[model samples]
Target: MTEFQTQIQAATRIVQTVYGLSVEWQPIPGEVEVVQACIGGREELPIYLTQSGEQTLCICYLWHDDEIEPSRRTELLEAMLDLNIPMPLSAFARVEGYFVVFGALARQSRPEDLAQELAALSENALEALEAFADYLKQ
Candidate 1:
């Protein structure tokens, strides 16, 4: 197995053991593997190990919806930026129609550290959702 494969296994173990979460490893031929798991009860988080030279793994939480109001778009964007300012180890990103919070880990990160990163990312995403719950009400 390759170094990344070994690290992936370690990460899976960490998520399962420490977080009490199950991981579904989806390996694409000739590409990096993605580990999928549900965090914060309703959100599915995707953990990706970049195939580029950086050898970094990123855990991302995405809230995708086309229903975001145009009037609230600027408010949401500003809120995300405000939350990102003091956040440690993670940041908010907007991709397509999704609002994302992601944390990156080095290829050599320990299993414990991986677990911590995942937890941090999950908490941040949850907080963001709660912070904007009023604006996001259906």
Candidate 2:
């Protein structure tokens, strides 16, 4: 297995054992390998991890562009910007058509550290969904 894949596998095991979360390898068609870690079995807000070069990134997709409440888009954007600094290890970002919460660590970080990052990212994602519930379409 490649170094990146091996690191992801180790981090997955750490997350499972330390956090008691379920993790699945996602078959995303791309150069970067991805892992989906389910926080409290809430598959809808699974954290996705990828390692490239010297960094490992964990991301959680909060919602899609079409899911946003049209009138509240500006408010949501402003709120996200305000929350970015105070949200611990995670930050709000737009990836293509999706809104996401993400964290990054050095690629050579310990498995335990990666696990913590995944956990933090997962928590931030849930909080983002809750905080922005009114900004999204039901």
Winning candidate number (TM-score): 2
Q: Rate residue 40 of model 1 by lDDT.
A: 38
lDDT (0 to 1) per candidate? 0.66, 0.84
Summarize candidate 1's per-residue lDDT along 26-88 as a digit string, tens digits: 555554455554553644555444435554656564566565666787787787788787887
- 22-123, model 2: which lDDT tens digit per residue? 677654667667766666667789777777788888888889999999999999999999999999999988999999999999989988888788877887
Error of 2 at 123 (Å): 1.0
Residue pairs with colliding backbones in model 1 are none
Worst window of 10 by summed lDDT in candidate 2: 23-32
* Candidate 2 vs. true structure, TM-score: 0.87
* The 10-residue segment with the lowest total lDDT in model 1: 42-51
